[model samples]
Target chain A: MDELSLLRRIRSEVDGPERAALDRGRAALLERAGAEAGIDARAGQGVRGTRVRGMGPDAAAAVAKRRHPVRWVGLGALGAGVLTVALVATNVLGFAGWRGGAEPAAADALQAAALAAVENSDPVVAPGQYLLVETDAVYGNTTNTEAGDYVSYLTINRDKLYVPADRSDDWVWVRSFREPYASFNAEGEALAQKSYDEEVAEADGVPELLRAPDAQFYGNSTVPDFDALPRDPQQLLNYIYKVTAGGGNSADGAALGWIADTLRTGVAPADVRAALYEAAAGIPGVEITEQVANLEGSTGISIGRVESADNSRQDLIIDTQTGALIGERRVELTDEGWGFPAGTTTGFTAVRTSVVDSAPEGGTQNGQFDREGCVDKGNGNFQC
Target chain B: MSTDNEIIERSLHSAGAFAEVFDRHARTVHRYAARRLDAGAADDVMSETFLVAFERRAAFDGSADALPWLLGIATNLIKKHARLEARAWKGLVASDLGRVDIDAIEQAAARLDASATARRIGGALRRLPAGDRDALLLYAWGDLDYEGVASALGVPVGTVRSRLNRARRTLRIAIDPGAARDEEVDHGRIVSASPDSL
Candidate 1:
């Protein structure tokens, strides 16, 4: 009475009903396949007829031909329509935008003063001091590319700035405006936090407490021999950037120029300004009306703008050295959509910065800086 | 005049010809599916199994019996559909009491002391780690030799041997608890003592 025999008998008994059910299921599947084939044939006929008659193609071509004229006419009519709609929507429907109202100009000046105090104080780059730098950028137009909107943010860390060779030592703590929908209850948060803690603990010389379930060996174990480690600083930076960007690895030449620039001058590089301009140009609805250099110094360049792609006025900062983007703060536009009724009015704001430390003490803070003034700042630290 | 291989090859060229391949392998695929998953979902798995195999026919090496390749595909599909596998196991365990053919168990018990052996084997199999269970099942039920099992499980041959040996030793100790303390027992004897001894 071996396990095999017992299993065999049980299998035989159960198999009967299964076989019958399978027969019935097969019949049903064949019937469904026939029905699907019929539907596919009908769809094919419809597509072929439409293609031959050219009705659908002709209509689409006609629309394409007349689209610009229609859009221009619409834009002319939109000016009056926007005011009435904004009044009705905001006053009656209570459609408050995602952007908040402006603080006092003095408050902004005070913020600048506070930032200047931190920057000018020759503040020792601590493990977690939030660094905010400002820069100005010129964006190029790219309305034809598939990229829906030109969006960019910043990455800050200790290892990224200082540590050039140690793979084990580099760990990023936060990214600026990186996670759009990150919430406490998200499924991956615990896993992400656990990995973060483990990396931090290992770097701090604490015995790694929790090995990743899929990890082959526990703490300080070198990656397997066959696995190729990054050989250069740029490759390492690309790896970190890939992780930070969450699969959106858009580190093209222009973006790389900004990174290289940030590394060199502590200000975002000149090419980043051009790249940002290019990104802005790709967006469908926005137009850059004006670009002016607000401040020029060894630290960075800040651009004060009259209007942006969304028709909301903005002030942008571009770092000259690092080519990393520094900050973008949108001012409320007075003309409201600027002759286009459907244009967005909500303003946007962003700031990017990095701090450098010659020597860092080990805790969780060894090689990273904090990012402030990001819209979703929780714990007042950027989460890259 | 057609070569023998060419004639056999030409016969299997079309979608209809490939559908015959499906009909021939469907039962084996269904059986493997039933073993890995539950009866309720086996047909869908079988259909999908063939669909994938059909799509990948251009890549088929055409040197081996397609049954094993089909089974491999079925195994992967089962892994992807883990919830279905769990449900099938649940259904099997729940229905085991009413469905048990006592005569068969008793006969198997007489030959290999199956009733007590089954209890021991079941306990040991349950206690064995996930990797070990997978190794044992792939070897014992899937009828894959060590090399094939290793390739199927994406593990080294040494790992497969270690896992199988560990599982067999554990089952032996469970069957006769007194054997747990033995120091110099032959590994071959331990493997032979198991109810699944080949």
Candidate 2:
């Protein structure tokens, strides 16, 4: 044989070690990258802010040098986070044991959640009556190094009111406040409250300073006709995957995101809500976090996926005892080299919906209360 | 349906996108590392290579496929274990000595023998300059063309040809001194320069 041909044959022999190498490499690299992406979205409020921050390393370096204005995912947080899962193929009503690799406590929790959802009656909304959705939604916490003195922490809360726009494809958004996770400047002034309809309307790209009779809101893009969603779990999961495929999220991520999005709308159809929970049981990487989410003042258990195309986990807070969605949170799993630190709550949407006749004037405001669902935000600690 | 570059672009905006990049190229990069190092160290080196690739993905040139870039990184990291590679080569060459254990059934299908010559080639490879060896191994093992080798080594295409020529000449001399001849008249070289632009 030719000398060159011999060399080629010898080189080909190295293929022996490749399979084992790929197996080891894939697990480690993917875990870190995958966790970073999924957890960031789940934990942080600033989706755009997080992406923009990742693009600029200088911003991360700036935080690293400082005392780190935000909180990070600690061992305690990870420890407290329940990696519990429950699987039942036939019926969540009573068929226990491992139909899949399902944990009993987690399984019971889900079954109870499903049962609660089934028993709870859907609130009736009449014509001209608004399905008032009050949420202390923190999009994300950004260090306001732009300002001085005591490091003013800014976590812009989206205190919104979603009223149907004459029962059509459109909806009205009345953002009542931009409550800074801050304290009083003077006596009788709890916090600097900015309740401007124009600012909220403009932020949502409504163009008008005030809500017009006909204007499309930013969040209206994801409003689904629940009547069309399948009643079956696997079918619903497929539907979510198919529709959201063109978007950024993975199939697992899409399912998690869709559930949160629908619940936040504050008008999830009763039938759809039950089916959605059942469907959630089938998605891989989903776990029951031991977090009792506080939505303004109410509480619920967090059950959702910690997977994403980014560095955060998206959790849906539902009352296992009552099947009501309390709120949703995003927990950052890895730093994503942005140096934000793991376990940071990147973004959160705390939802509380109440049916009311006729829209309240100026909109419903955030009262003297705190929203502590997953992580503990002690008094005066306003940001992540 | 997204290309690696497209997936990387989307990964910048979304979390799952980066996983797609890993899914596509991790195996190729891993096994390539195994060729340079033992299977155990290859696992670690492959992990390190990808982690570096992911961290620096933002600076990645969007027009290129990530495999050559990834293979290049693997080559650089593997350079640290040059001694391990040398030992592996020497041991394999030694094992090739006085071995006539080719099965009758296998021999019936096999047409020729090149183990001793290949063993000499392997030792000769271990003795080349790190850059030249990188170029050679990339060509021989990376399945990279001239352009790919160049890009992987961060050298010019012309330089890649020179390194390959030099690497091949050294091996040729070790195998058959008279047949080694001059580097200029190696017109018999079947190297596809077309892939040099990759």
Top model number, DockQ:
2
Q: Point out where model 1 deviates above 4 Å.
A: A1-13, A16-384, B1-13, B80-131, B154-159, B174-198
lDDT by residue (tens digit), candidate 2, B1-198: 557787677666654346556656776776677766677777777778878887678777774578888899889888788789888777555333323357788863432444555467667877888888888878877788887887788898889998988887887788887674674554334667765442
- Lowest-sum lDDT 10-residue window in model 2 chain A: A363-372
lDDT of 2 by residue, A1-384 (tens): 444454555535454434434444443454344334433333223222221122122222112211111122111122111121122222333111123422344545666777788798576667777777676766443321222111112354554454553556234455443444532233112212332233344235332111323222211122456677777766665555444332334546655566666666566666677777776676666677766766567788777665645657787788887787777777668865332456766557676777777653431111111111112133222221
In the range B53-112, model 1's lDDT, one tens digit per residue, is 655655664534565556667777776767665554434442331244457647554544
Model 2 residue A188 CA deviation in Å: 26
lDDT string, candidate 1, A1-384, tens digits: 333333333233334224444443333332222221211111101110011011222222211211110011111112222233333322113211222212333224323433443344332445534232322221111111122221111111211222212224432222111111111233234433443454344335332122111111111121222133232323433332222121111212212222222222222222332323332222222322223333223233443333222233433344433333344433434422112122222222233444544322332321121111112222222222
Docking class of 2: incorrect
Judged by DockQ cut-offs, the docking class of candidate 1 is: incorrect
Candidate 2 ranges beyond 4 A from true positions: A1-104, A141-154, A176-178, A182-215, A218-222, A244-250, A307-312, A333-342, A360-384, B1-198
Interface RMSD of 2: 8.2
lDDT scores for all predictions? Answer: 0.36, 0.55
DockQ of each: 0.03, 0.17
Interface RMSD of each: 12.6, 8.2
